[model samples]
Target: MGGIDREKVKGSFHRQAKTYDQYARVQKRVVANLLDQVRKEVGTPGRILDVGCGTGKLLAELHRLHPEAQLFGADLALGMCITAGAHLAAGAFVTADAESLPFIDGAFNLVTSTSTYQWLPALDHAFAEARRVLAPGGIFLFALFGERTLFELKDAHYQALKREGEVEDITHRFFPPSRVEAALAGAGFDQWRVESTLEVELHADVPALLKSLKKIGAGNASPRASAGLYGRKRMLAMMDIYQEKYGTTDGIPATYEVIYGAGRCP
Candidate 1:
């Protein structure tokens, strides 16, 4: 995509609200790991906001862990907001963007997100918003798909397009760790910690992996994708190349580079 179509992202998530958790095995793990990290490093907060809280999974888990703490969830997709509202009936839910939250300054002591920031075109504004909404000593913790995410599939796609005499690099790319750090510094976080880990999910085949992506609302929103440039002939070619290169006895590996970042507000 030239730049992510925010509306498309919202629409895709809205459509997948009900089925998201079913196909979000990797996301669940990311949330669990992020929460576990917080429990070890940040402790419990008096008030918390989970940005892009899809279906309220992370917020529900947070409620279970810290029943006394205030919980708030925000998402751009209306369907996601509705679903989250049901699960967090006693808490608060809002349809909002990460870069422009509706909450007042210092409304929360902790802000958390997982598998959400990757969809954002840039992190600086969102990080600033997070800082703007946090109290002193509050923490901004998140896990996002790093630059290396989906490398194998992107490589295969590139190869297929090259073989078909196409030159545009249509594969979407993610931000690197340096960019995240820069954003945190620009947002004037008091201090920061950032790290990365590689996680892989196995699919029976390339087609199976593509289907799983769609089911999880991770479908490509590229202009090329809309133009049907990612067409049948190229798709078959990509599948063949992916199998030959990355397929194994167990399955084809789809790798995600998860970058976890934590910043403390002044």
Candidate 2:
């Protein structure tokens, strides 16, 4: 897997910190579904740690559910951590990387993340770190984008560029459910379950879809992604291509293939 540019990712998310919550509908939904699953499978955790807890939405939710439990959040972006801390005046927030958590072994009973792992180049390191921090028999629950995520947008970009004998790769190749399961197992997790889901959001046009991504600071952080901002010509062409191919009676649909995984450290 190609390594992600950490500074680039931090900058993007930091820039969107103030406005992220407005356009993070899909992310919020992922957190909600993940929490619901946690509730169904096990009770509220005694101590909770949310990796890549952007904007602290999930932390706020967890706080609401288990007011007495200890809660914490960490993210690579300082601005995101600051914003999260300010929003949720209770939880302890820190700037940390998932591959190398700034905590002692078995520091948390439950570790979770949503829409964050795809940005990581090595799932093994991250999973291992999660396992290290989790107590014995503790649950690790997470949701990540799978390979099929943003296919429509990706396809549109390729097709638009191909018209001029060029190729545009603007997104990361997200890990599949099978790969994620293998990574979790390799990290010493047991009885893990991985499931795939398609979450679709409708936009009136391609620009709106792009705006949604920008608002959530989700512009690709892949090393392969273009460093420069998109040009007007290419942007317009992609919009046309997407509308021509995947447009429905309602609107253009941006599909997110969400991979949900949960298991226990043994």
Candidate 3:
């Protein structure tokens, strides 16, 4: 459980490929924001690479905005690639890994990823690979969850387990903003600027929130797996604790802390 297994992670997304678009609200928002940032800084580009291009939604938007650009979409999941090929603009889809892009170096002027970097087993290598694939002065726009995401739930779950004299491991993993920024810098990206904004959404209950995450093929893709089954009693107790702690003015509670970052490749 040192790091994520890329094949297993890819398979999870592949299984959810057909239904990913239906439940990817956070992803959609993040990608739109990333695209907007790109437009503001880099304007229209002649070539673009959509890394971890889930269903090619971002690629489609880019193609519409910059139709002249050669847009390429890459995802580790073949199913995602196929789905993207069918949904995205013609000639803009490929199956590839983020850490090892197949295209030549400096081929793309803009590289964008939406809601998919956290699952990478090695962020430094991935960032370096992304920098290598980008042309000089190219832009890299991405969105990932920060360490604060699901804090209440994670804390409550672990606290409950610890209180019961048991240890539990969760599948989700998130890095701090500073750590992410350092990785980007270490990857040789210059003019780097990173910012994180909190995005909270209300959920009727934990099950609903968990279901949405699963539908998007985004949950605990890390190599670490949860031990001890969360039975009905434990789940209910956990929910009670979460509600007591995080319930808002409204009846429903909120989950998720989304972090967005964008930088330029030197």
Candidate 4:
């Protein structure tokens, strides 16, 4: 994968800041599952920092879970940070990139992110930063989209582009679980665990899936994505390909491959 344009990523989430929660059902589920894991492994962290804390939903829940702990949130998008501030009464929200968090070393006892690492260009740098910011034995936990995510859409795009004689990449190359675990280990984390699961989400149609993705600020931010708006011909071709191959009696299926990672900075 090529380097991601940070400004474009910030812009995408900034535009969706207000409506993200409405369309982020899978994300909410991921957060709930992550919190459950946290409860099992770590009862309460003395200090917490949520990287890429979009709208601070997890932070809010963490506060309720550990009312006495200090909570903080950081995101690359300022609009998201502002929304997080409005949602949380006492926690501090900062606009910062995950790859280079602007915090002192050993500042947090727990660092977490959910459904956000896929946009990052360098997982190693992000993990290094997370490890740098965590206290000794602190937990670093996160969930990211794995390589199988959106395979339905990806296959459709591939076939559609091939038919047009354009063999170009149109999606981000999501990391596999092995790569994620290697980065965590290289970043000085110990006692690590990485798990992946494939989940299928049903959408009414191709258009509905696209709309849901846009509403949640998860539209294709890949630099390899087609340069211009997909014309009606391409759109129809992609939709037809998707429906013919992956559509079900219930609806069109969009597959989500989620990777959950947990480690302690040693």
> Which candidate ranks first by lDDT, i.e. highest?
4
Tens-digit per-residue lDDT, 28-113, candidate 2: 89999998977777575788999999889998988898888899999998889999999999899999999989999998888989
| Positional deviation of residue 131's Cα in model 2 after best superposition, in angstroms | 0.6
What TM-score, to 2 decimals, does candidate 1 have?
0.96
Angstrom error at residue 189, model 1: 0.7
Could you tell me the lDDT of residue 56 within candidate 1? 92
Q: How many clashes in each candidate? A: 0, 0, 0, 0
Q: Could you give the C-alpha RMSD of every candidate to the true structure, in order shown?
A: 1.5, 1.5, 2.2, 1.3
- Which ranges in model 1 have alpha carbons more than 4 Å from their true place? 227-229
Candidate 4 global lDDT: 0.88
Itemize residue pairs with steric clashes in candidate 2: none
State the lDDT at 169 in candidate 4: 61
Q: 227-251 in candidate 1: lDDT tens per residue? A: 4336789889999999999999999
Q: What lDDT, from 0 to 1, does candidate 2 have?
A: 0.87
Could you tell me every candidate's TM-score relative to the true structure?
0.96, 0.95, 0.91, 0.96
In terms of lDDT, model 3 sits at 0.78
lDDT scores in order:
0.87, 0.87, 0.78, 0.88
Model 1: lDDT to the true structure? 0.87
Give the 10-residue window scoring lowest on summed lDDT in candidate 2.
223-232
Choose 3 or 4, whichever is better by lDDT: 4
